[model samples]
Target: MNHDTDAMFRTLKPAGLDTTVAEAHARRREQDLAAAWDATGSGRGVSAPAARRRMPRVLVAGLAAGAVAASAAFVIAATDGSGNSPGARPTASGTVRALDARAILLASADSAAKAPLTTGAYWYTRERETHFVAPMKLTEAQQKEVDRKLGTRLKGKTKADKSSPVTAWVSHTQESWSGRDRHARTIVGIDPKIKFASPADEAKWRTLSESQRARLQLDVPAEPHVNNYDFSHAKLLKTDEEKQVSALAKLPSDPAGLEKTLRKWYQDERALEMSLDGRTSENSFAAYVFGEAQDLLAGPLTPGAKAALYRVLAEQPGIRYLGTATDSMGRKGAVLALGTNGDDTGPIGKNFEIRLIVDPRSGRLLAQESGDRKAPSLTMTYEAMGWVNSLGARP
Candidate 1:
């Protein structure tokens, strides 16, 4: 990536934005990513034309924005060239026949519909998030600027060693406890660790002060930050707090009815956006519905409603089954890919793919991953989720 793009990525602070503003920022970021990828080739056999293919506008928009809006798409592909439909099932002869995406999702929906409903004082969730940073060389001017900003000079390397870049991964644990009465608390433990590609990289990293490292988005305080939110007064989601909580049980329980209700909501939202901005993209309806479904899944919902969401997902286009895989937490589940031609390349760039791992038996989402198939750039794993009696309690 270019220096400007890298700097923009490092400086993004979306914590303060409302839902609408955050979505706008997310769109701009996607455009920036596409532009950056175009300027600098991915060198992964993905041609410019293929990489620039107009994927569904809102593919994974909800996941990218870290908000409760529209989410990504999932494609369907046949595993054994059988061209099975959504109701297809595995063979009974003990021979392993890979099931299609629709079948997997439909089965999950059935399981979800049977789940027992429970209530508690708070809806709690624990998640682990990881972000991978690739190595990139910096220009001499960039290096000097960083050094000056940090008030330190490199130990050696007058000019020749600027070609080296560092490789590292940053990760953190996030927990949330939300109550139906519009009260919520979120805690984020920012733990960033760096692994140098070489001794030179390590030396360069070691020269920076702790504050400087934090400024560069390389380090953060060891302590966890807690934030309290009063949803009644906050503009968080598209709907108000009362509706958001009430819809958990009030949403349609049948697939067709649920889809219809969600479509109406999408149309109303778009109409409002068009009236305000004079124009709104019409390609994001599917993404918006999926995003809403995802958001509802994170909260307490009736089993029928949850199952309806899975059925709705099964009905989408371009969903492909990637077989089964283990999540970041080492839990095995069925995997699905979206917005791709059954390859690593997609609208984002070469070696990048949007994937979701779902637990079919329990009809729960295990993880969402984006980037390289071997090593994704971002991975969000659901460690635990359920109703708890108190804020700090786990499932």
Candidate 2:
């Protein structure tokens, strides 16, 4: 394996974005609490607004899908007014100017309250992930280690850190479906061909022998891998939607019970990803839960469950509202974001932001994305969701 493969592997793990979005909001709440702390300590209140953050530039490619329910296209333009995106557009002030983040979410909750439950034989969701790679050099020892692990000799000229770097851009399409019966399928692979971002990188790749490229996994002919899962009973899928939605249906529509249940679910998922305990502070756990809520939406969500989700998010701190913009699928929606700085162990070890895109008109979620100024970013646009009578059917 070359430096590119090493870098890609490094990027395949869950990172600080999960914490950042959660922590960013947690810090805001802390500040509010700290104001009371200050008053108690010095007999005077200290007021400070959370720092305004800038959204990173994002490049969303066009999406094309075969027969599917709901919308198929996904596209998100940069909201920073940087003019760096082809999808960027000036926000129309007349309609959205009066709406704040909380107002937007409240409206969303109202919309969700009226939404209907969907039932089908299968639930389908299609999305795309784009990875941006920069030029990198690999040492000879590093190349040998990669070769040893793969049991194949890499045929590339090895050089130290000072050599010319090679880089490529790639995108992957992922499709997943869960059935009302007892089956689930996920297909993931690079859909479009990989392209060298820099012409110099392209030239460098062309200089390599075809065998070397194959060993390096630099060729675009590779197929994406598929993973299939089947469950004999819905109880086996109880970790997520199956559990949460079912619980929501039993709980009262009041916010307190709703919040407690959702928070418990968040704690459960967080425990799976990281170690935490009674002493562990709940810094952006709510934000993390907000991000995770989309997965439940892909399944069946009752109107009360949907409204509870929006209401919980409306109360969370650190959610920044960016006026309407198009997701990668070309659907217009309002954008809310939270994030934190990336560390050495984190994937995309640069500062990144996680954004939730919600349909402004219907208050339905459209997409979610995590991106940074450097390194690759991931955006998941929900094309179509709902139950179908059969595996291949769409609703």
Candidate 3:
């Protein structure tokens, strides 16, 4: 396998979780792995569309713990392109010239606390996702194996045929609307305009067979279909969405109370994990809370609760400021990262970073990125989020 593909599998497994819970998280990881494989034109000939099906929310619950653990190998990069350290404090002019990760989180908490609340019939959100697929570098034998699987015979006679690897950028957009009645609708639009590294690579791609191209996941339908879900039966609805919405209504506003409540929830979740697999996790409590907060930040949160979550993040260790950067949607925001690169005797022995870009003015989460610092393997940008009166509306 190529380095990119190998790196993906190495980083996919979550540390400190047993096979049972890890398998649940694997559903999502499989999609990502398949995408990378398809982009590289290696591995089993599974179409990206087939592997890109969205997993159920039941499987999505408690994913933050694993995600945070997967990023434990992240090495800190330079802070803000400035020679300053991550502990730098903002100047007294009220302008954030250079601020530490803790200070940034604190400022975001203050902004979140004062944010205005809104209400509507449905909660609407629009997000863009980009997955970078590195070029596949295969040996002659590996290329032959790929050809045999696809029933193709394109010999490397020309220089173009012998090109080292072809790089691809895969991107898509997803929109969702969830009502107070527990009904939800989701739409996923795959971007047809995939960017290639060079015209030579594009030319090489056209020479492949139709089936071979399909395995590349480039033939996705431009018009996305809508998926609907009904969860009106409160007693029967035991999904994570139900739990999240229910919890949002009752979360304590104060930071102390919120932290206390979250800890109780964490203990309950850990207990459930122990009951199911009989394995206890060695992950830090702060890391677990940080992961949970990361997931909750995307949902409809009360201003006070959101503020408390930010404050909770401020207390966690290993967080560093990455300065300002533009998200996939071309919006500028302050980037904060949490991770460390060191010898970890965990299930997954690979290292990667997780970054969260926040709008300092509104304390809104703009985007999230994960993977190596040079090129993120996965990036999710929040284009729009708020309450809407109708299912087809945007906020």
Candidate 4:
């Protein structure tokens, strides 16, 4: 196995509750990870569509995840690190096919690489410096705030998600205590309005049956709002155009390009500077995105300008197509809608539109607009979209 893979396997784990939960909350603050769960065109798509209009009432199913920090049996990576198994490949496609029940647990072994963590190599790295990670004491007052923000109840969630009142522990490297003691305890719960029509609706939910409330609040609403449409499924509905599952069975064996943009768009030093203040709320969110986007989305592109597209889109999860359009740079671009990867998938109120401009001829990005994915998914409407001829049409 490659040295990186060996090191990755040796260092990774699901992480303690404080680490996992913090990682979740931190992802929310980054522009890219914030969009992952939405139906818009992922980093691979060409256009930005408008967010669908949604009804005032919407169903919001909550999600949470957790991991117990264990030594011994849990420290190993993969079902067995036997030679070049399928799980070793980092391709964005079907690496999961190799996993059976045993591999599933091993699959999560590296889940620790994601952000909202503040240890090891996590504190300072490239464009990800926009994210911050520096271990600090979890105070009593701070724990409550974390619970309030997690906004996704963990009762049915994962172990870290379920660990309540937030107990935090740290093993202080493999040399530290080597037993079942927790390094940290973390609890997560849904925001008050996450399900109800509004805060007032929350009151009504308390009076409603648990199943009734769960069912009513979990149905993704369908309104005229642009955010309501799932661009991933749009072609299937026939209401929109068709976009086939990627013809490339697996994202290129060794995709490239993302590192360039992050290096260019957000200077590494500045991003790192942000990390220097790791205790701030913004640092947590930034760190989450840095870690998640680094491995989860990066390194799967074909190359050149397309690589840049993959980088931006990989980070912006809820982005979708808004059809063809010209950009401020006057390069014709395919507009894509944007949304927050937030639990609410229905109509997102306010600004939530993200746009990307591509050179129609070279397929290079000319300009970009990353907006909220709620209402106004695009700053430019579908009709307003067109190709920009840097060369004159008359000529």
Q: Each model's TM-score?
A: 0.62, 0.58, 0.63, 0.22
How many steric overlaps are in each model, in order? 9, 13, 0, 61
lDDT of candidates 1 onward, in order: 0.55, 0.49, 0.55, 0.26
Residues 79-193, model 3: lDDT tens digits? 3333334333233332333355666677678778888987777877777765444333444654554444334577745533333234544567778887777788888764545
> What's the TM for model 3?
0.63
Model 4 misplaced stretches (Cα beyond 4 Å): 1-316, 328-331, 340-350, 370-395
Clashing pairs in 1: 60-72, 70-291, 71-291, 74-319, 75-318, 75-319, 75-320, 76-319, 76-320
Comparing candidate 1 with candidate 4, which one achieves the higher lDDT? 1
Weakest 10 consecutive residues of candidate 1 by summed lDDT: 43-52
Scored by lDDT, model 2 comes in at 0.49
User: What 10-residue stretch in candidate 3 is worst by lDDT?
Assistant: 42-51
lDDT of 4 by residue, 289-322 (tens): 3322322221112332233334334443333334
lDDT of 1 by residue, 177-288 (tens): 8777668888876444454445765777677687656644456457898888777567654534324554565778899988887787777766765765566543354545
- The TM-score obtained by model 4 is 0.22
Candidate 2, 359: how far from true, in Å?
Answer: 0.7
